[model samples]
Every structure is written in C-alpha cells, then in structure tokens.
Target: MSVPDTQVVVVGGGQAGLAAGYYLRRQGLDFVILDAQATPGGAWQHTWNSLHLFSPAAYSALPGRLMPPQVGEEYPDAEHVVSYLRDYEKRYDLPIERPVRVAGVHRDGELLRVQTDSGTWRAQAVISATGTWWRPFLPAVPGRAAFGGEQLHTVEYRNPGDFAGRRVIVVGGGNSGAQIAADLAYDTELTWATQRPPRFLADDIDGRALFDAATARRRALDAGRTDTGGVASLGDIVAVPPVREARDAGLLKASPMFVRLDRDGVVWADGTRAPADVVIWCTGFRPTLSHLAPLGLRGPRGHIPTADTRALAEPRLHLLGYGDWTGPASATLIGVGRPARDAAREIAGLLRA
Candidate 1:
C-alpha cells in the first residue's frame, strides 16, 4: 500500500469543478483539478458566441468570487462568462492541470485510481464534475438520418448568421432553443418546433429566483416536509432579453413538433410539410461520465444515484454539477456553491477520520 498522490482529484475545471476547488482549498485538502480543456472557463468557452447567463451577473457568481457585471448588459453573454472564469482561476490560484482528459476511474484498495491522458493519479476521494457539455444529446427521431440538409445540435450552433438564407428549424422548448431561435428569427427564415407549447417564466423570474426556489426546496426536503417543488414547477424558459424581445415581437412562436424529417423538410402528423434546409436540435445534454464507467455506478438513465453529492455505492466518489440529482441546481454557477462546500467538508471529514 503506497501513499495516494492527493486526498482528492477533481475531474473537471468548469464552473462545477472550480466551485469544488474553492471549498477543497478552504478545507486545506491536498487536491488537483483535471480539466480536459486546454484553457479555463469550462463549458462557457464552448457555448455559442451569443449565449448569455439566465440571471444577472451579480447573481451568477461562484462561491468565493463575484463575477463582474458586463457593462450595459443585464444578462452577461458567453464571452463575459469565459473571461470571468479565467480570472477566477487566477484569483483563486487553484491547482488545475488542463488538457489532461481522464480516461477512467477505478478502485484501488482504499484509493481511487484516476487514469488520465497525462498520467494516473490516486486519491482518497474523487469529485467527478466533468458536466454534460461534451455529451450533447440528439434525439433519435425516425428518418432523422435521412434528412438531406444539415442537422446540428445545440453544441455545434454558433450564431444565426451561419444559417442565413436558409430555411431553419430550431427544435426543443428549452432556453437554448428559445435564444437560438431569437438569434435567427430576423436573420433567416426560422421555424421553432417543440414537443409542447413553450412555457416562459414570469418577467421577474431570473437565475436568482430559480436559485432561491431550489434552496427552499432543499430546505423543505431536509426538514422532512413535503417537497415544495421549487424551480421545477416554474416555466422552462427564462425570458431573457433576446427571448423576451422576440416573443413580444411575435417572432418566437413555436410549432408543434414535426413527425419526421424529409430530405428537404419536416412533416407534421397532419401531413402539413414545412421545408427546411437546416435542423438545429436544442434538445439537451447528458452528463459527461464516460470516465466513471469503470466504477459501474451509473443507473439505467446514465445517472449515478447519490445521497446528496456522494455516490451511494461508493462513498469515496462524489458527482457534482451534473444537475439536481447531485444537488439542487448544482449545474449553475451560483447554485453549485452549497453542494460543493458540503461535498468538500464531507470528504475532508472522512479523510481526517
């Protein structure tokens, strides 16, 4: 039995990973963060250029540092977020090794062996926070493969100008779909299709409201009360400036989901056809947990069941920033702090014991 390289090895450097690092450092733990990206900012760097936070800059902050507000922008865009994350890392002086993708995590006696592209690291505790950005999910609709025009996922979409002069269909009713559609509404011929009517949050609802609701729900559950059904009960889309403007201008109307795709367009169940040269699927993403396959903890839905943030089957392992399963709104920049702090404190206590 040899000494482990560190007490903990965080498997990402994105918002979630950075949040974990802040708490881990405060705990005075020996840890290292492994980020696949060569640079910082995590998934924010990869999002579409026009992407903006759902909340104001003042509310979309990490645990220790507040993100600087973007000048003249209520909702800071992707570039602002990337800049903030890069500076946050420098301010915190976190130990992060970039471009070192983790291959897998395996059990080694009492330690967890993390195999990465750079080298293998052994740790007493492992925080898997790779997130879902890398795993863009495209629904398997019939005849999708036969579509002649370009079909792209939310991950691949950049801006509306890219699809100019083309008949485009933006699929999904989520925030991504709404924002992207707004971006293309005036630039090109656009059709927004969703499984159901899109639901928009109240004008006042923002990331702060959502975070507060999530916190209340968490507190209710902890107190053994009936689930308050926090943010989940709210509408799906947060009417950000772009989305709101488009909606108010009657440019963001949603059509029922098309039945199938033809070479040139989509067909509704009613046999009405809408021609399209491009289909942008803003469906959603799955957690990036291929590295955890060796642990055999993922359930049928490709999620690892956990109590709080710690894996039930493997107490030494914790999953953060994936979503509510790890912790309520743990995927958000402002929402991840509580869970990250709790996980770090637990890991420190266990190692100390």
Candidate 2:
C-alpha cells in the first residue's frame, strides 16, 4: 500500500530519458530515471559493431551536451556514441537507477503506480521513453519455423566476420538492412530483400538534410501552407561511404520479398528458390510498452494514441522515442530532445498547478 513518491518517474535512461531528465532538472523537479540496462549507455551499447550515426557527432547529440568529436571519424560509431551518453550522464549528474526493469504501470487513484523489478514508485506523472531497440520485429513468413538455416535479427548481428563465406540474405528496406548488407557483401555472398526497392538519398545527402527537410515541411504545415513535397524522409537510407561503395560495386541491390521460407532457403514470389545459409532480418521494431498494458491505452495495433507526447487516454502518461506516432521523429537521437522538452514542460505545469 505504500510506495516511494516523486514528482515524475522517467521510465528510461536512454537519449529520450536523459533529455527529459535534463529539462526536468532545469525546471527543478524531483524526478528519477529508471533504466533497464545495467550500463550507462542504454541501447546504444548493444548496436552492431559497424553501425555509425548517419549524422555528425554534433547533430546526433541529445540536449544540453554536445557529443565530443572523434578523431578522423565523420560519423561516430556505436562505441563512441555509448561513451558520449555515459559522459553526458556524469556531466549533468542525472539521477538514474540502473538495471531496474519496469513491469507494469496502472492508475493508483490520483497518482500513477509504477511496478518494477526492484520496487514501486508513485509519481504525479510518468514518461515512458523505453525506445524500440528491445523489440526487433520480423514479419511472419510461411514455413519460417521449418527453416534449418541460421536466422538472426539485427539485434543479434555483431560483425560480418561471423558470416564469412556463407550465403546471407539481408531483409528490410531501411538503413539497417542496407548497412548490414553492405557490411556482409565483402565477406559473404549477400542478397538483399525487401517489400519494395529501397530508396537512396543523394550521395551528398545525410541526416542533416533529412532533418532540415522534415523541419521545413513541419513549418509549412504549421503555417497552413501546403508542404513542398520531395523533402528527404527520415526513413530514407543515407548514402554513407560504405553504402555508396556497395552500390557502385553492384552489391546494394534489393530483391522482392520471398513468399515463404523452405528447409534450405527461401521461395520467391516468382517461385524461384535462393539458397541462403543465414538470414538476417533488419525489418524494424515496435514500441516496448508491455509495462503500460495495465492502463488499457493501446489500440488494436498495439499503439497508444498521443497528443504529441502526452497520452490521449491518460494525460499523466507521456510516451517518448516510440516513433513518429508519439511525435515527429521522436525515435531519433536528435529528434527525441524536442518531445522530451515538451513533455517536461507539460509535466512541470501539471505538478505546479
């Protein structure tokens, strides 16, 4: 019946949670960040070895601290990003509790009760910034379970060396699929498959251009003007040096998705069979909202309706870093800061009132 009380309970310690904590501290609110990861880097610690930010270090930083530059690296790798996050936490002295996995959250009269592996916390508001890395999604293909080949999601992929000399199939049209395919192509016979052809940005274009285009579109819409189409989307693949090189070498081609998986390989829609020794799925991820199921806010598709970052069904609940549904580009490192700040301001106002 009793629980520790706080002004706000931020249920993640990744970029989104850190950004929220930064703004909450500036507002002088008593808040605690509960992170599932034992380490300080959050999900960045688990990314693939070759994964690099499409944006420069400065552009990829969270609020309050600039990601320090790496020597001779245009885009910081996963390790560098993790190190920066650890340094950011130390610099701000953000109050974070690690290795605390939230199990569920529900209404406790006028307050929200957070149930976690460690203990319970009753807070005036809750910010769910858990992000999507924990829930890598793969589409269901007929006979998939019967396949004898090695199947792995992007989460489990570490390096190309493990797949050397094997016939590999990289699935998905997003950045992860392209990058992983490029990485594997050098050491293995690789084939890329997607629902459709992957769109590639211009050689010179990168995350900065995508962010700018998104910003301009949003501005036009806010002013009741028709958005000028043709702006690069956040999901569009950035033509990184490696990806471009792969394209130039004719290694970045995508095949239409197969109809089903067989014992030894996949059967394409045209009934062509391609032998694959390993299948790596880079499809995408869903929001990690299992903790919020008790609230009955999720829709049939497992999405919670949100007015910006605030949950429509529960105003005291704010969701961040899930994806565009929560806010514009809320899932990205830089894109998350804006929504985090907004959520903090709203939470502060509610507590003050």
- For all candidates in order, the CA lDDT equals 0.93, 0.88
Which window of ten consecutive residues has the lowest lDDT sum in model 2?
227-236
Clashes (backbone N, CA, C under 3 Å), per candidate, total 0, 0
For model 2, the superposed segments whose C-alpha errors exceed 4 Å read: 1-3, 220-235
What are the per-residue Cα lDDT tens digits for candidate 2 across 1-353? Answer: 34579989999999889989999999899999999999998888998898898888988989988888888899889899899989999999999998999999989999999999899999999999998899889898898898899999999999999999999999998899999999998899888998888888888887777666765676676689986552444446888888889989998888999899999989987789999899999989988999999999998678998888899989999999887667666777888888888899999998889
Candidate 1 residue runs with Cα over 4 Å from true position? 1-4
Q: Model 2: how far is 73 from its true place, Å?
A: 0.7
Candidate with best TM-score: 1
Candidate 1 global TM-score: 0.97
Please name the candidate that would achieve the greatest lDDT relative to the true structure: 1
